[model samples]
Target: MIDNIRENNAFEADATRDEDTMENKFLTFHLGQEDYGIEIRHVTEIIGVQKITDVPDMPDYIKGVINLRGKVIPVMDVRARFKLPPRAYDDRTCIIVVQYNGTAVGLVVDEVSEVANIARDQIEPPPRTSRGKSSRFFSGMGKMGDEVKILLDVERLLYDEERLSAGLVDQA
Candidate 1:
């Protein structure tokens, strides 16, 4: 019994260490010319762009929902969310499925770059000067090599009082 307990404790320790390592990893994707990243821990999977069924009265950014293997999930266009000019979706476009507040939300991005391991020390807080509407979605700026990736706050991006009150998220 004591040996079994020791083995279980060792497994738990290894799992904790794995989680800690993942915490520093970010899944980088692009919008247009700029790169953005979200914590890898929150990412579930990446799929190619698919047909979206529009939901009425929702925000323009919320492109609609998609049936992902029988499960319906809301899809949000990152470009539209940022109020950026629309572009044609091509083969490079991808839908990054991520968990947001227990709900699965698919973020439509231009193209996925790579999974980058950005240490905590390499991350800097967002600037306080800009009061842009989209600024609230920025969590930090991660420095990797000669480039910086705009790290996003996934929860903040997905959460909206209007959507919650309308039960739109719950519908998916």
Candidate 2:
């Protein structure tokens, strides 16, 4: 990870409070057994469990769309996107409203974890041995005490040019 930079606004403090504040807040979420976090700055809002309007003729990962205060935001099942086994949604299922590439979209996760204030020193660059598959989307792996959090490069994660070409949604 990049050298530990210091910036603490108390905006995204997590359950593990440390003396060294994070430069930014990471909004953590779960996908199967793994834990992931994206910059809280990219997060627009977190809406509770809601009725998802299923749109026909779409990918399985596409859970359909939802009316977010008038705007129709598509919700993607992260578990499906990651090719994990499908499971029923429970109380932990939450929609994370993220604004990327000039549009707002909701990502459905197994559960919303917590906001973590990760320091630069706590983050390590994705190992070259990552096989170059998940490397592009991950900036680094963060060492959050006993639990390690995968730090995602938000822009690359959602706003992929190839994904846009799929005609799913105009990411422009």
Candidate 3:
């Protein structure tokens, strides 16, 4: 029994170490022509676009909620949230379930790409656009070879009080 306990503890420690190493990784996805990324730590799972029950009195971007396993998760249309032109959901349309600020929200994206390792040095601050209008959504721009992925600040995306309401307020 003692030996088994020690082995289990060692395995748990190794899993913790693996998570620590994932801090520099980003899960890349796309909206339209542009690619975007969010910290891998925030992502829990990726699922196909599910039926979203409409919730009235909410923002247009807030499509509604979906039953994910036994949990009901709120879904948001990334395109609508960014004020992009709406498109029909195809096989490529999927939801990126992310846990941020203790809430699990499903981000409806165009498609998921791949998980890329973006070191701290490879990330640059977002450019200053007049009054930082578009910069608020980005944490930084991650450069990968010749391509750039706009790294999103998940907390800011999900928890901003002025931008979001109906119990999805910022906890921190």
The prediction achieving the highest lDDT against the true structure is 1
How does each model score on lDDT? 0.91, 0.78, 0.89
How accurate locally is residue 127 in candidate 2, as Cα lDDT from 0 to 100? 70
Task: For candidate 2, give the lDDT of residue 109.
Answer: 86
Q: For model 2, how does the per-residue alpha-carbon lDDT over 1-172 read when each residue is reduced to its tens digit? A: 1333322334335423532343557999998889999888778899886889999997887889999898998988877766678989899888999988797888888889899888878899977654435456778899888998988886766655466577753332
| Of 1 and 3, the candidate ranking higher by TM-score | 1
At residue 107, candidate 2 shows an lDDT of 87
lDDT of 1: 0.91
How far residue 168's Cα lies from its native spot in candidate 3, in Å, is 16
The alpha-carbon deviation from the true structure for residue 93 of candidate 3, after best TM-score superposition, in angstroms, is: 0.5
Arranged by lDDT with the best first, the candidates are 1, 3, 2
The 10-residue segment of model 3 with minimum total lDDT is: 163-172
RMSD of each: 4.9, 9.1, 4.0
lDDT assessment of candidate 2: 0.78
lDDT of 3: 0.89
